[model samples]
Target: MELRWNPILETWVMVSAQRQRRPFMPKESCPFCPGSGKVPDQYDVYLYPNDFPHLMKDPPEPSIQDDDLLRVERAFGSCDVVLYSPDHTASITQLSREHLARLFELWRDHYRAMRERADVKYVLIFENKGDIIGVTIPHPHGQIYSYPYIPARPAKELDSARRYWESHGGACLFCAVLQKELAFEKRLIWTNEHFVAFLPSYADYPNEAHIYPRRHCGSLLDMSKAEAEDFMDGLQRQVRIYDSLFGFELPFMMGFHQEPVDGAEYPYFHFHVEFYPLHRSRDKIKYNAGSETSGGAFTNPSSPEENAEELRKINAEL
Candidate 1:
């Protein structure tokens, strides 16, 4: 695998051809299953190295050279799979509150440990659920990738926040957005003491939601114990609402947006979670075609207020 820089877009493209051989929808025994000899028999939460990781700690020299237009470098990073439960059929929403809290704690621990490394610059915690979302494994799990450099999306967010702070006399960009959402209230799905889940006015995908902390924090490590518990509660409730909306497990990609681990304080950056559900409706799946992929713009079919209203009506008691 190698990282090729696209100067025009100012982003890194990872070319990992070997990942094509990874197992897809296996019919045999699950590798993540405990007692299957692939993993330990009994465990509440487990972390293991990805068998086919895109990046490595010590990658080989880049296959190509860096020119005036194109820059190439070795892909240096780490990827780990986090098992949420021992059950093969369980989902994140299905886990008990205590178990879910444990998972968040594990994520926090891994994030801190990875950021301690000299080469690590960013740590991304994310989960891709459902086969339609292209998850090769069906087990209840998430993944963490510690990169040697900050990824493009987060970098863009940081840049935006920094500019916002500079122009607005040091005000946090995300906090400002959250405040606006709260004032409007039409896009709010639900809220608790510590966090709020709402469909953003600038949502890219239908039914996409963003969860923001009530307090301004740079990352999960900054969260207090009480805030952590309330964070878990808010997350679980959001997932429950999604499942209830569709009458089944929702196919979605969820990720945490946090400050970089480059040892610099980013007071402007705010920690949050974003959920992008694949389905636009019960039987329909949203696809990113020409305009979205090539044009670098998103076309949301449904209005945020409408989607929020639909989600708000669901009973998120779980």
Candidate 2:
């Protein structure tokens, strides 16, 4: 089994065809099962390395630091699944604000701890909801992965921000985007003093939406407690809109972008959360297909402006 790294897209795609042979189970092996050796009820939070990893765990350390054309390494990182609730059936949307707030607090603590390690340079916190995204567990939870180097996507975003700062004399690029979108009022969904949720004009999905802060901030750790609360409120509201759009609980993969742990300033980087749902129509699904998978471009069936309009109307009616 070999994983091919596509330099064109800067994405490492696993080409292990044998993985398809893995058995399918009708029921999820609930990781949060009570008194189970893998998951205990006493743990509100826990961090550990992934039992199964695409990257090897014992690769040479110097290989990662090498700047040569060829690099190698053991997966000098960690992947920990977060158990968000004692009830396996509950999702974040169904969780109380208090539990969500504590989860946010735990996120901060995890990010800070991971950043302190010399080997780790980026902390990724994300959730993959629904079976469409291949979430093995039906339980409400997310995962935290600490990497030894910045991933390609974040690296690209950081470079984009840096270039924009250099060209615009330190003005934040996303701030400008938010300002212009708010003025346009076309793709705008809902916004408050602290955060704004909108569908971008260049959205690649039928109803993709993003939640970003009004003020420029490098990371979630930079946000004050009140600001974090506002973010959580905004997150819940945006998700509710998504659910309302289809009249069903929407499924999405949500992730956050924050400053790198390499100690470089990213003044132009504004923290945001993005959600990508696979559904395009009420009952139909959108496939990435050849164009998206090979061409690295997307063809959306609906316009962002229209999606925003519909979402806003639905939310208002709700």
Runs in model 1 lying further than 4 Å from the true structure: 316-318
lDDT (Cα, tens digit) per residue for candidate 2, span 2-37: 334455566544333444654443465554666657
- Model 2, position 120: C-alpha lDDT score: 74
Where is model 2 more than 4 Å wrong at Cα? 1-29, 43-49, 54-70
**Worst lDDT window (10 residues) for model 2?**
59-68
What's each prediction's TM-score?
0.96, 0.88
Cα distance off (Å), candidate 1, residue 106: 0.9
Model 2 global lDDT (CA atoms, 0 to 1): 0.75
Question: For model 1, what is the error of residue 42's alpha carbon versus the real structure, in angstroms, after optimal superposition?
Answer: 1.5
* Clash count of each predicted structure: 0, 3
- List lDDT for all candidates, in order: 0.90, 0.75
